[model samples]
Target: MNEMKTDTIETIKRVLAEVRKNPDLAAAMTPSTDIVNDIGLDSLQMITFILSLEDAFSLEIDFETFDFDHLASIAKLSDYIAGRMKEHV
Candidate 1:
């Protein structure tokens, strides 16, 4: 049920908009926007975002050794998710 199979950025944005409860942020977000620092996703929101993202993208995130490195920005997160999705496929 991947809504945007090859468009993880948009998919991520859609998920973020839902998690943030702010539709305007989706429109305002660029690939360069920092999700952690700028978007200010706290612990609970981050958990919700991760869960929602896994559901939305239909994949599980390996949190065993996962770091917040991917959360640095949207583009990086998109790249990470795209890579992870590829691995999932």
Candidate 2:
């Protein structure tokens, strides 16, 4: 994979680890899980997780350009992050 894809995957893994650290949240997650439906994250938790991801990856997500609800799967999240990082560059 390319550097951006690698970075995106790493970011996703880090975010997953964060979710797994929260005992209440961990039980609901899997690598292929959907953050919203399967994990049952509310809007606040979702924003918090996104912020954590932004910090971890050193990327600024343009909220105006993002459709947050679509960030359900790791692949989608990775793609979004990769796109945002590309915009920053």
Candidate 3:
């Protein structure tokens, strides 16, 4: 089944919580929120977040071509994920 972008966003929130568990996350979250800058994820946490997203979506991220620019914002990441998921399907 194809997942909606909203589902992707929600999954991101869940995965982020698992990785960071930031108390202010809910209040800080927005489509424009920068995944890296806003969340302040360390290198390890960032990797964990990516892996968790891959697992949650049941799709492997193409690190060979993955653009770190996608990490610039929540909307960008969500869009990239949705595109990747489509490719997987």
Candidate 4:
């Protein structure tokens, strides 16, 4: 894969590691894993997860521009991050 894609995947895994306390939830996380339905993350957990992601990537999340649906999957999250990164560049 290209560098950006590689970086996104690694970042996703690292963020998930920090946010997902349950081993089962972490283990079930794939590219298509749904953060709410599949991982069962509550609002507080979701906030922590997003905060972890923001810290991991050194970027501030603009909730207004961010799509809630993108949080559903690792791939989508990566894409969202990538898109946000592009905006800063």
Each prediction's number of clashing residue pairs: 0, 0, 0, 0
Supply the TM-score for candidate 4.
Answer: 0.81
**Candidate 4: pairs in clash:** none
lDDT (0 to 1) per candidate: 0.84, 0.69, 0.84, 0.76
Off by over 4 Å in 2: 1-7, 20-32
Candidate 4: 10-residue stretch with minimal lDDT:
20-29
Residue range 1-89, candidate 3, lDDT tens digits: 23587777777877787789775575558777788888889999999999999999999999886898999987789899988988978
lDDT of 4 by residue, 1-89 (tens): 67887778766766666676654444556778766677667788788988888888888888898887987777888888888889888
- Over the stretch 8-87, how does candidate 1's per-residue lDDT look in tens digits? 88878888888999988888988888899898988999999999989988988888635788998888888787778888
lDDT of 2: 0.69
How well does candidate 1 score on lDDT at residue 48? 99
As a whole number from 0 to 100, the lDDT of residue 30 in candidate 4 is: 72
The residue pairs found clashing in candidate 1 are none
TM-score of each: 0.87, 0.70, 0.88, 0.81
Error of 3 at 68 (Å): 1.0
lDDT of model 4 at position 29: 62
